[model samples]
Target chain A: DVKVTQSSRYLVKRTGEKVFLECVQDMDHENMFWYRQDPGLGLRLIYFSYDVKMKEKGDIPEGYSVSREKKERFSLILESASTNQTSMYLCASSGRGLLDTEAFFGQGTRLTVV
Target chain B: TQLLEQSPQFLSIQEGENLTVYCNSSSVFSSLQWYRQEPGEGPVLLVTVVTGGEVKKLKRLTFQFGDARKDSSLHITAAQPGDTGLYLCAGHSSGTYKYIFGTGTRLKVLA
Candidate 1:
């Protein structure tokens, strides 16, 4: 089975602190994505990487940035954490194709900013 | 921007009841997908409908895509407690790899 692993299940950070969320996929998928899930807004994409070292901004990418140094690993970075930035973060990976492919996701990381 | 809208933000019903969740969009899509997510875990793919007016079934769950490829629906027959979760619909536009997910429907099935 394909596996997507998140570095932290729960995290708490103070305002103005820098935070890092890590995601690793066991399968050699070429696409990785970062999204923030809220109660009523659903999952909003923050950033996505189609290949190593290549990243694209999603709808809600203002406070977030991404790094994809290796094919299996993708990282989400919060330049400066704020109270409003607290939310459940999800990581997903999918195969390289134009066709609609199913994405495999990791257990989400719930972040709380104080 | 492409958007998918889901109706019935929350639904509660007794076991053995039937229910339907609707996902509507104004823009055409290449494919649409349904997912169920449990607490503390990521959303799991249930079905993907590609062709217009297509219907797919997985056991008691039925998924249908509109003929214009702009809308979809998911119907559950004899829903059980195991079916309780957040249901999300996502649409993928033609020539784009990105998916726009709809606001989910939270279903609670009680015994």
Candidate 2:
């Protein structure tokens, strides 16, 4: 089975603090994504990377940035955490192919900004 | 803008009941996918429908794609506690790489 691993399951950080959420995929997927899940808004993509050092802005990318230094690892960075930034963060990976190919996801990271 | 809208934002029913969740869009898509997400975990792919007017069944769950490629639906039979979760639909335009997700449907099944 393909696996996507997130670095942290739960995290708490103060406002104005810099935060990093890490993700790694073992399947050598060419696409990586970061999404924030909220109660009614569902999952909104923050950023996505199709290749090393390449990133694309998703629908909601104002408060987030991403890094894909390695093929298997993609990182989401919060320049300065704020209360509104607290949410369940999800990481997913998928092989390069047609758009419908299912994307495998990590367990998820719940971040709380105080 | 490409958008997928899911209907019946919330649903609660007793065990053994049948229910259907709908995902609709105004724009055409190449394919659509259904996913179920538990409270603390990321969403898992339930099924993917690519062909127009195609229907796929996974045990008690039935998924169908619209002929216009602009809509889809998921029907669940014999609802159980194990089936309770948030259901999401995602789709991509004909040549796009990113998948746009729906608003989601939260279902609760009582025993």
iRMSD per prediction, in order: 1.5, 1.4
Which regions of candidate 2 deviate over 4 angstroms? none
How far out, in Å, is residue A69 in model 1? 0.6
- Clashes in model 2: which pairs? none
**For residue A78, what is the lDDT in candidate 1?**
99
Best by DockQ: 2
Two-chain DockQ for each candidate model? 0.67, 0.72
**DockQ for candidate 2:** 0.72
lDDT (Cα, tens digit) per residue for candidate 1, span B39-98: 978898899899999999999999999999999999999999999999999898655658
Candidate 2 deviation (Cα RMSD):
1.2
What is the CAPRI rating of model 2's predicted complex? medium
